[model samples]
Target: MMNHMKGPKGYETEGPRLIFEKKLTKTNIRPDQSRLLMPFKSLIRNDFLRPGIGAILVDQRNVKVGLMLTRWDMKKNSGGGTLNYALTCGSNDIVKGNRLKKDDDISFWSFRCHNVICFALVLPP
Candidate 1:
């Protein structure tokens, strides 16, 4: 029996059993498991990011920078999820997220909660 440990995202057990999965690559990660083809980088809890919340990535001092959605790890305290910097579009290259802060304009949407709202930001042209 393989040992299981608390991991980011979900359960961090052995990459499932061979009987359960076929064609193993990269340790135990299967091609069918996730849609993320690129390598993922681990993220940690910060002043703005609460683990497991959908986050919008933007550059410092700019609001119009390309926005991408990312999530935190399932295990709040220990585990953190992944993101690919290559994906952040044209605003400015985020070297290290020098200025990541929570947008108070938005609030935390917890797990199993499907509350969503719409707002508009009209910038002067």
Candidate 2:
């Protein structure tokens, strides 16, 4: 049998695409870190995001949280580099408010609403 997670409310008609999913680690849930590092090359669409852009994401409880899209470059020995993305600003509060802990699973979804970039977080049951 195939199991499918329910789509977010109000998005049944045209649900947002799944951007990425992560299992919270020590650094992710820790208050000191205060940032959620997305996987390298995880961003498939650039039209919706830019470096230093502030994004508002709605959590599972429908609470809108503000976060920043930051780009980090890693220098390589071969004169090349890699780009990485992370969510900052309100990461700590999301961890605290949602009582998220290490090993918790979370899925992030993205969609454009009226020319505005929006995201949604789906927490494990």
Best by TM-score: 2
Write candidate 2's Cα lDDT for 32-92 as tens digits.
8888877567654455567787777777667778899898786799999887788899998
Worst 10 residues of 2 by lDDT: 1-10
For all candidates in order, the CA lDDT equals 0.24, 0.73
Summed backbone clashes in each candidate are: 1, 0
Candidate 1: deviation at residue 118, Å? 14
What lDDT score is found at residue 66 in candidate 2?
85
Give stretches of model 2 more than 4 Å off.
1-15, 42-47, 74-82
Number of backbone clashes in candidate 1 = 1
- Model 2: how far residue 87 lies from native, Å: 0.7
Residue clash pairs of candidate 2: none
- The lDDT leader among the candidates is 2
